[model samples]
Target: MSNAYTSPIPIKRTNLGHALASEWTKIKSVRSTVWTLSIFLILVIGIGLLAVANTQSDDYQDVPFTVPAFFGLMLGQICLITLGVLVTSSEYGTGMIRTTFTASPQRHRVLAAKALIFFAIAFVASAGSILLVGLMASGAHSGPEAGDIAWGGTVVKGGLYVSLLGVLALAVGSMLRHSAGAITTMLGVVLVPAILPGFLGIWESTQKLGEKMGDYNAINSLAAIFQIDGPDSSTGSSQLVLLIVITAAAVVGAFALLEKRDV
Candidate 1:
């Protein structure tokens, strides 16, 4: 009698592409994604419609041009942040993070894949919200020419800005590892600076500091990507400098901690 031996097939490690696919599937399957996106649509589209309906100007002349669209942008950004938090924090919530790390040892790859997925989701939602608002606004007007849909660099950049903010939120969730903590911190990032602006205004000594700093607060900084006459529009170079510095610090810090910390 002869003995026969067989070798088992080699298992391949999950690559970034596979990781992205897996993460995308998990994201789409979650009930949370649907809820977040639904609420986002309601607030953005609902508010946008209201803004157009209640416009002080009955004619197209009454519209602020960008006000209807901007209103939706502002509200849609919140949903982006929520989705961002979920992308990473949910793994921690369900204790699946350990498995994720086991499957993909490179933390950078995990975060990178997550951010990419989140950006794609956010961009689609944000862009769609903008387009819907623009359409609603156009329908509300009955002039010789329909209100032009401003698909300018400003609008495109604005969409990108919202997507990046989602990426930022995901990084925060990864760093904090707790949903409550990540959300609270993000709200602080959105609101605290504005609260201090008034105090700075009152204090003559710090007036300039507050004026220059407060006018370009966090939200404004992000919102500038969309504004034709944003807070820093007068000096394009200055706006670019501020945007680069703020965004770089945030993304770099997230990457650093993600690389060094234990999952």
Candidate 2:
């Protein structure tokens, strides 16, 4: 009997869900993620404790919401940025992005998955940090705001603000596409606008521009978000708006880059 010709069937390609799972596994597997998160937890909680220890209460109203938030930021931003840089850039660093692109050719899906994962990570970190601050600040103090300490609206807003900062970093990382470049840009974006005025001799220019820049700077704007009083048209709204607009632009730019740039 003559044998019939036979052909092998091709393997099916995995869907987006599988790609997401694979990406998640990559993120969780990184040592930098673990270390950065550990340091973030310790710094946030430790700072809260330190702030409470150093605090002298005249009136509960004296306890500025900005205080503990700053305490957290002192440590949180550094480590959070580290994590953010690693999230997307590590793949580039390891040449894993090629495989990732192969698996999920829709670049937007990769970014969306990364954003979702990083957002969740930020939320958990913020919650822990806020809870630590609340616990530390729960004791005796002065001012009509004594009741406000435990239920302080600032803590809630502060947590969300920190989460957004993480998102901003991720967006930035995507735009820069290099870990060091991303980090440098993040620092410059936060610091340069505020610091330049202090050094420049252009007093008149600095005042107008400084005030405007101050309004738009990320650090300044985040300070607004974490402020007890909350932000309106005044104070740091300009800075906050600037940061938001920049973040939006960065995300859009990242998407465009991913769509066109060879991974």
Candidate 3:
């Protein structure tokens, strides 16, 4: 008679949780994640404090107390973008993607896990830094002239905006599968629209178009959110909606390509 055989390990069906756990592990174990996020914090908090320290209470007369954080975030966002690219593209570079796919055959689940994990990390870091800076600025510069700035809205929207940019960068990285290329494309996505409007304004034929672009570009959107450029109705909601649509499209494209491609 044959002896009955049984395994000691428990067997279970895999789901999104498994993929998320794997992604969480990978993200936390990597050094790039630490370095990029650390720099992001330093740039945002450091420059924000400096801006607040250099100014007097009267400086809040026309703008919100949160305005100083905008200066730091402009530079700090690059670090987030870089981290986003690295999250996806670095695995491809090291040929770790094959193992990932092998372990999690449901490719879209893997992607969703990456996006969710990265977005959460980026959003928390961004919001925390912005809120910290805003509180410090408010303590230093709050006055009647500040006009009851909405600090809560500023922090939440600012975090969402920056986190979406990083998510978009992750989508681009997934498509390009190259860290440097994806980072550069994201930078151009942010900078070119903001910069090109100025050059275009020099030409009479494109002046209106340039003005419109300048009004709706990322910089203007972010500045509007922080109330740094004063109150504006046109820039804030529309720009965020545009970004959401574009990022959704990019994420869909990444998933479609992931299913069709060899790797």
Candidate 4:
């Protein structure tokens, strides 16, 4: 028989979809994803509901119900960041990355797949939870004085915030290849740059620069999207652009490192 007729196995080129499936399997099978996301939901939904229960209808008279949801999400960002780091870092920790690279042989493809899968999972979960809490908070505080409920921008923005944070963490993990080290770096990414400006603001010489940093910082940008931050309309756009820029840079760095570094 000819080769075509006699061959029992067909050779098919692997693509991103296959990689994504593999990554999805990896992420789902891991305990970190479960524990991190579970705590995220509890903190987000629990705090939001608890806040609503304590507040009177008079509270809604001046504030939008979306406020409480944003509050919960702000604190829950830690869970998202941790999960992101674990996605890639845990593999390195357990020496599974070598096997993964051996199976795929295409490093960039694996990274991209991981990013897409994690982003989808994180964004959907966060957005859905925020919407649920927002609706519930609105109902609990609804009255004639309760103004229009704008959940679209806030929900999407908040979702993107957490999702992008996870992506950043993943990128950092790939570069560092250590779970603890990457997690610490990311915590600084989320915490330090945001507050350093405040400390610098104490010096009159640096006050202007500090104010600029404060205005463009991620947390303030997130708050600005929820309309609870400040009068500056530029904070939202500035923060969004900053995140996209930083994430894009990290992604490039991750791919470059993957090529140069040994598994």
Best candidate according to TM-score: 3
Q: All predictions: root-mean-square deviation over Cα?
A: 3.7, 3.9, 1.8, 2.2
Model 4: per-residue Cα lDDT over 141-241, one tens digit each: 78776666455777888888889999999999999999999999998887886988979888999998888788776677778777773233332656877
Estimate, for each residue in 189-216, the C-alpha lDDT of model 3 and write its tens digit: 9899899999999999999999888977
Please list the C-alpha lDDT of all candidates, in the order they appear.
0.71, 0.69, 0.89, 0.85
Estimate candidate 3's alpha-carbon lDDT, on a 0 to 1 scale: 0.89
| Candidate 2 lDDT tens digits, 46-153 | 776777777656333534433564666755777787688779887888898888787778889889788778877787777667766765566534345453533455
Off by over 4 Å in 2: 1-16, 64-66, 140-152, 228-241
Pairs in steric clash, model 4? none
The residue pairs in collision within model 1 are: none
Cα error, candidate 1, residue 220 (Å): 3.7
lDDT of model 1 at residue 129? 73
Lowest summed lDDT over 10 consecutive residues: which window, candidate 2?
228-237
How do all the candidates rank in terms of TM-score, highest first? Answer: 3, 4, 1, 2
Better of 1 and 3 by lDDT: 3
Clashes of each: 0, 7, 0, 0
Choose 2 or 3, whichever is better by lDDT: 3
lDDT assessment of candidate 1: 0.71
- Candidate 1 vs 3: which has more TM-score: 3
